[model samples]
Target: MSQPVIALFTDFGVSDPYVGQMHARLVAEAPQARIVDLHHYAPAFSPGPAGLLLEALVPHLTPGSVVVGVVDPGVGTARGSLALATDEHWFVGPDNGLFASVLEAREGRCFRLREPEGDGLSVSFHGRDLFGPAAAALARGDRMVLGEEVAEPVRAEARRDAVLYVDHYGNLMTGLVPPEDGGARLRVEGRNIPFARTFGEVGPGELFWYRNSLDRVEIAAREGSAAKRLGAGTGTAVAWIGGV
Candidate 1:
């Protein structure tokens, strides 16, 4: 079998030392594993939207890859650690609903992660000290190092009609999937945004909704920022105006 790929997904922006530290630990602990920086700028302190994005992106990842997801707002608190094994992927992170959408979208098994007994884990940086090691272990096929299996992981109530993320181009990625008919209009900020095939399909500065690469409903301007034009950001409300 080929070496497993370990992907990192977190809100730790690239400028910080947190992400680099996790990378160093993974490299040292699982030298044979391949590491991929899937994403770092997930919605800060908001795991529900991040989870929705993760659910959409997970299917596009390499098969059997281990994803280390960390969007924990309650890191130092009593929040439990989790290790999830889906049909095609493994996820290690806090149990504060960071992996909720992944579990909901697939058949998976959840385990409470077992922290290193005397590794001097830090309260504020579980992503580096705890999840990184667990992901490396899973990538190395050492499931025994994880804790006992759990019946189910914690699930959060995610808003399907909210903006999950905004890209650098100002495209607003909503949590909703495109309608099967492909004719539904999106209502946002009191404006009815129609669907377009792509940015070129709309006039310059005109706003339209389209199915993004991940198949999620996204609002974008032809050559401008839909987020700026609509005065919207992450967690903005979106509604489907047309019928099913």
Candidate 2:
């Protein structure tokens, strides 16, 4: 039998010990599952753009996988926790609209996470204390960690016209899909970027927009950093020639 896939997504950079603790906790909870580090740099303290980026990444995950996304700025607050089950995957995260864009566009059922047992949960680090274990349980097909069903977890206004993430290569991944017209241009940070099929189609250092692997409109500067060139990062507004 194949091992279940448990993917981790968070804002905790690899340089910190937070991500390591999450890995250890997951291993302790569900050792039989295969853990995958989906991403750790999720536009720190920004859950809206992070959630949108998570939604965009849904198509790339293995079917029946469990994803634990932690970009909570309200970790220690009165906010709730969530275990969301979609058709192809399960998502465990805080209820602070971290799963908003995913649940908003797709058909998903949300459940409140049960209070953590065995160990004392850290108020500020629910990723390792709560969500990580719940995700492990979900990956193992054990639903005991999930509590009551959430009628509606939380809702967020996703800006499809804004940058959702800036990858390490400095590519600007936006929430907006490319326009139907192939020749459309994307306006960003006071400059109009033309559309290109791919990096090879444009000259090095030239700024352009293209449909990324995840099918989102992305800004890039061949052989250069688009973010640096445009002085843009996550939440940077973008629009097509006719408008977003």
Candidate 3:
């Protein structure tokens, strides 16, 4: 058998040494470890974005990979820091009902961490003191304690944004549906909008629904800002009640 893969995900941006420090601790604890950086820019305190990112990445990781996800906005505040061993992978993080729930939602098996008797603990920075070291040990063939098979973990629904991330050209990314059943229809805020593929497909200034490269439903102005004209943002609710 081969050594386990250790994957790291966090809100710690690459500019700082926080991510490096964690990696170093892992190396020190388990000299021959494989550490991978899944992502660091998780939209600061927005667990929704983190959950979305993890969901997209989890199914594809190598079996037996130990994934450390540290997006705990409620770290150190009565939330339990945890080490999770699943059938497919392992996850370590603050148990603020953030990460494991989303991970376990799509997984078939999971277990929580119980404190190892006499193991020195860190209260301030569990990611460094706890998660990093534990993952390292697990990677080194050390036996680990698995937690529980939770039935209802927390969940976050990734909704279609009213306006997606603003692009360089100032084109507002809208959360409109594309051709469904090979056709299109658009409605928003209780009004029926128009539909088109490109700006020239519809009269200038008409808003329409379509899928972008990411295949996400987008709302866009034929040649303008659907957001500024309609007033919306990341979480604005959208509905695509028609197709073909």
Residue range with the least summed lDDT across 10 consecutive positions in model 1? 144-153
Ranking by lDDT: 1, 2, 3
Which digits, one per residue and each the tens of the lDDT, describe model 2 over residues 1-244?
A: 2688888889998998988899898999999988889889887887788888888888898777899999998988999899998888899999978889888778989999997766678889999889988888887778899899999777665788998889889999999876676678878999999989999999989999999999889999999999999999989998777764
lDDT of 3 by residue, 144-204 (tens): 6445645544544444344434443334444333555534555566666655665678777
lDDT of 3: 0.64
Clash total of candidate 2: 0
Between candidates 1 and 2, the lDDT winner: 1
Structural similarity to truth (TM-score) of each candidate: 0.97, 0.95, 0.66
For candidate 1, lDDT tens digit of each residue in 183-202?
78889999999999888888
Q: Between candidates 2 and 3, which one is better according to TM-score? A: 2
Distance from true position, residue 1, model 3, in Å? Answer: 4.3
As for lDDT, the candidate ahead, 1 or 3, is 1
Using TM-score, give the best candidate's number.
1
